[model samples]
Target chain A: MVGKHCILELYDCDHAKLNDEAFLRTTITTAAKRAGATLLNLITHRFEPQGVTGLALLAESHLSIHTWPENGYAAVDVFTCGDQTMPEQACELLRQELGAKNHALKSFQRETPAALATAVRHPKA
Target chain B: MVGKHCILELYDCDHAKLNDEAFLRTTITTAAKRAGATLLNLITHRFEPQGVTGLALLAESHLSIHTWPENGYAAVDVFTCGDQTMPEQACELLRQELGAKNHALKSFQRETPAALATAVRHPKA
Candidate 1:
């Protein structure tokens, strides 16, 4: 199956929120639900001095975020297979909750070789 | 600090290897070490009948893989923040271990807003 992957670069996020492990875990878990994905498990880590990293494992795929509190930056990835899930929605939720002043988002498709062949043969289909 | 993120799509792989949870865990751990990343924790889940999903949490960032044994396809993501780490090397190791006959790889840098501003102003520095 083909999947949609979104890479989000959140800038000028709230430093406190970026370093708050509990908040991040809640936000990521909520983001997964917002994307219409099935949450299998959620894991998070808090760095020694600062920063936080989290991953939300979903039945469709996975969502992850690595925050750099000192820089007011956070990098997020949301990937999901199946047409039912909207990975973009998850990215948007994270951006909003993190209070990013500015952000850059890149979205792409992950297709298997068979899917690529099908797209080539049936460009309109 | 700026980070490198690599997205790999492996196709035409061995179905048995794709579904082997033990092998995947070992391979991903080894890939992280090869990239000069510090491993924190590893978590994996095997789906009913077939397929597997694994994540290697690293001090630099994280590496993850999701396999589809039925279609002989797998998707991998390796992201690392330190300049000393090589995300590409981890991706290559995974590609080899998974035995993907044909694969597609995309790599990019994830820079924070501060870094972006510095890059734009310095231009050559």
Candidate 2:
């Protein structure tokens, strides 16, 4: 499939208290819905005395987040199979909701499956 | 952190019988273990009458997989934080375990956090 994927590495987030499992689940679900995406299923893990990690499967693609409360850092990856803009919007919502600062974000345009298969088979021969 | 990420889109696989929830959990767990990565926690979802999706949190990074039994296709994303080589090895193990064919794979090198932050701040200013 042809699509855009965004991988965001959020750093120096101010909301350490907001990085709990319950908060992440709510934030991710709301962000996905606001982006006009459907949520298939979600799983969240609470690493005791550390931080929370969450993954949400969307009908569009997927979103994964990992938090480091002690370091005031968080890593977020949002990938979509079709349109590219929604992932950026979702990241903005997340940054605003979590009060992140000194943020870092990266965008990637994924290659089509056919192109990848061709490269693999040929291998510069 | 600078690292490599491998996103694999496997197609035309013939493992319909192996796509159950239990089998996926075992296979993914085993693959991660053999890669010398630390397992944090895992969450899997079973789409009844369809297929399975799983996400494993690894100290090295993360692995997410989605299967479409009817279409004989699967999508896997493996990402690492520090070292780049482990993700590829993990993907190979997954492909072998799932008996995938006609596979397509894409590799990405994530930008450093500082670089991303600069780009965001400048934005052609």
Candidate 3:
């Protein structure tokens, strides 16, 4: 299967009042829906009164988010397969929601076995 | 805040013989440890008599795996930041564990916000 994934590292967030748990759940569901992801199940854990983290499995792929209340930072990862661009859209939504001042993002393409073999022979610079 | 992530999709797996739930948990933890991920908390769900899926949040990043017992297929995603290549290493371990004959993989670089803005303007063809 071929897929695209995005990893986001959000820094300088205002976590003290961002409704951590709610934000995690809402962001996952909303992003999944917006990207037309077929969600199978979701589970979230709120670490006492400090941080919150969650994971959602979707037919298209998956979405995960974590928050650090003390440091005012968070991280998000979204992966999707099929005819959709939900990860990118979700990133935009998260950017707006967190009111993040600065961030670092990365993307990866999971290559098929055959292609990967070829890639190893001729690595990308 | 730069990181790397890998997404894997396995097809034609042996679901009946393979221990779905056990595999899910083992793969997540082992892969995380091998990748030098700092474990935080892990949660897994087993869909009665059928499939299993799990998520592990690591200080380095996160690991997620899902198994489709009926179709003998599974998907795994591993992402890590810092001076590590755990995602790739984990993919290799998974391939060996699942006895997967064929597969597809892809990788992406999530440019920092500033780089992303530049990428958007220049675009990658």
lDDT of 3 at B37: 72
Q: What is the fraction of true interface contacts found in candidate 1?
A: 0.22
lDDT of 1 by residue, A29-102 (tens): 88998999988888888886777788877888799998878778898999988777999999999999999999
Q: Model 3: per-residue lDDT, tens digit, B51-123?
A: 5667787765578876655555667877766664457878777766776666666655544333222111110
| Shift in Å, residue A103, candidate 2 | 3.3
User: Candidate 1 on B18-40: residue-level lDDT in tens?
Assistant: 98999999999899999999888
* Residue pair clashes in candidate 2: none
lDDT of 1 at A8: 94
Task: List runs of model 3 lying over 4 Å from the truth.
Answer: A17-19, A47-49, A113-125, B1-22, B33-53, B58-60, B66-75, B80-89, B101-125
Ranking by TM-score: 1, 2, 3
- Which ten contiguous residues of candidate 3 chain B have the minimum total lDDT? B116-125
Candidate 2 C-alpha lDDT tens digits along A1-125: 34467787676676555456788899999878766677777877666456667788776557888666666666788876554337888888888878887688888765444432322110011
DockQ for every model, please.
0.24, 0.10, 0.08
Task: Give iRMSD, candidate 3.
Answer: 14.8
Best by TM-score: 1
- Single out the weakest 10-residue window by summed lDDT for candidate 1 chain A: A116-125
Query: How would you encode candidate 3's per-residue C-alpha lDDT over A4-30 as one tens digit per residue?
Result: 777787877786634367767877788
TM-score of each: 0.90, 0.74, 0.64
